[model samples]
Target: MRIALFNDYRIGSVNGSRVADITEVVDTRWHGTPYVINEFIAHWDQINPSISAAMDRADTHELAGVRLLPPVPRPGQILAAPANYRAHVSEMTGSRHRPANAQALLSPREVGFFVKSPGSVSGPSDAIELPPIPGRSFHHEVELGVVIGKPARGISRERAREHIFGYLVLLDMTMRTDGEHQEERTMRKSFETFTPIGPFLVTADEIADPTALRLRLWVNDELRQDADTADLIVGVDELIERASAVVTLQPGDIYATGTPDGVGPVEAGDTVRAGIDGLGEMSIPVTERGW
Candidate 1:
């Protein structure tokens, strides 16, 4: 089922152009607090039996025309894997470092994960702010975001899919070479409005094979990255299995499973869109920020 968190944190179950305001059904019990998508998944079975029964319900209320937020407003953690795709690795090979050597030099073999500041999160229609930091280069990394459904630790690669709640398209906006420290990538990736996620969350049952989806990104309407998740060096199952070995994967945790080739930059007034088939798309505008 396609689920979305709309204006003012209202929940909706998508049906073509129409959106059923599950907000009433959801808010009837848990009122006043900002409801995150994870809350719906956690309580739907017990709180609303109708929701659990129908994936496509009719629009019950007037749809609110507003911006979509990252389904999880306050995810416990946002863990992202870098250079996990073979083609992306190939692109970074000659200049960044050879993929053969990255495993050791860049710690790719260590299962490296970068933590994006949760405040960096934005939605499909949100404007991406280009903070005027001199001598900086910003790049867009289109990634497939994985949302955790239940709490798990030390999950096996074979059973990883069982722990997944849903998927979302992610734009891992980064500020390359931020100069905070020459040794880390997080410096450029943790800026405000750097991550654009959503449109809607597609439940795991809808996507039978996560590794088979096509992922792509277009900058100002020009296709730059076009690669499938099948190109991933360490697929989703392995990523979850590996990450679980280090930290517990909570119900609201998010993991951006790396981007493919075609990494580039965007300035203010630019449009960036990324998506995965069967999942959904996210389009964000770029705006310059002074100071």
Candidate 2:
């Protein structure tokens, strides 16, 4: 089922252009925090039955009419892969997008998974605000986001899929750093609204093969990033295994499987759109400074 968190943190099951409210079926108390999404996912097997039974009788609304929030409102951690795509690595190694006087690029095999501040995350419809950093080139990177459904540490690649809850379209917006003052990637990527995710989360059961999905991104209606997850230097299972070894993976934790090539800068007033097959898409506007 396509699960979404819409206006006022109401949980819904999305069907086509409409959504049916399933919030009542959930048994967990939100405690006044949208972190309820985490509990909902963690107990999905137990909670899904009630939600399914209620779908037919629940109140429905147009999907476009409701304001959407990040599927995982406050993830415990936002672990991401860097240079995980073969083309992305090669491009940064030699392409003009490479930072000036930078060392040769490294792949995930060498660098491993990195963490970004969870505060960087925002809803799909939220405008991406650029932090005040003069002479900075902010780039857009569209990637597949893997939401963890269960806790796992030292998880094996063979058992990786078992812990996954779903997938979403995640844009890893970045601020390019020069060689003179090389900055940490996490800091460069952790700015507010830097990680805009979710049109809705497509449950893992609905996706046959995550690697087979195609990802596409457009800036102001012009296509820029286009590729398949097949090109990832490390696939989903391995990413889970590798990441779990470093830190405990919990429900609502997101693993941003790095982006494919064609990354470029975005300035104020530009709108960015990205989508993945099977999963949904989102459009967010870019602005300078904070809200």
Candidate 3:
């Protein structure tokens, strides 16, 4: 079942044109102080049955009219992979004098992940606020976002799937610099409005294989990125296992599997549309940061 937060942070199950409201079910079941995304994810298993029953109710709302919020608005942590795709690494590192050699690939073990600030998270329909810094190159990295369902620490790769709640299409908005000794990678990616996630969170059961999905991104109708998860140097399972070994993975934490090749810069007024094969799509507008 596809779950979403729509119009005023209401919880619902999404179909093509309609959404079934399950807010009441969630409230009555969880009895939490505030009905936030974290609470929703924490009680997902308990409320799943109720949400399923509410799907057939007659008071569904039009999906298009509702404002879609990030599936997990305040994810405990936003862990992201960089150069996880061999082609992406080559594209970023390839020089005018020497072309990248695919044979010399660094495993996820070698190139560990970075944590994007949770404050960077924004809804899919939200505008990507371009930093006011002039001459800074801003790029879009479309990735598959993995939502964790339960708390886990040092989980085995074999059981990694058990911790995943579902998946969503994520746009890792970045700012590139030319200086040799630049700011830390995490700092570059932690700007507010840098991470755009959602459209919908498709439950794990719906995705037969997470590693075999197609990802694509378009900037103002221009296709800038197109690659399959199959091209990932380190797949989802290993990412989860490896990440958990460092820190305890909590419910609502998002693991953004790295982007594929075709990364490019985006300017103000450009609209970026990105998607994963079955998870769904997200279209985000771009705007200059008004300080």
Best of the candidates, lDDT: 2
Q: Each model's C-alpha lDDT?
A: 0.77, 0.88, 0.83
lDDT of 1 by residue, 61-85 (tens): 4334655666777787899897787
Per-residue lDDT of candidate 3, residues 43-128 (tens digit): 77887777666666636889988888887888888998877988887776663212233224465778678889999999887899
Ranking by TM-score: 2, 3, 1
Determine the C-alpha RMSD for candidate 3 after optimal superposition of all C-alphas. 3.3
Task: Kindly indicate the candidate among 1 and 3 with the higher lDDT.
Answer: 3
Put down candidate 2 lDDT per residue, 1-291, tens digits, no spaces. 898898888888999899998887665478336877887898888887787688878999998899899988899989999888878877778655456677666766787888889999998879999988865789999999999999989989999999999999999989885445657878989999999999898899999999999999999999999999999889999999988888899999999999998998899999999999999889999998754
- TM-scores for candidates 1 onward, in order: 0.88, 0.95, 0.92
Tell how far residue 93 is off in model 3, in angstroms.
1.0
Ordered by lDDT, highest first, the candidates read 2, 3, 1
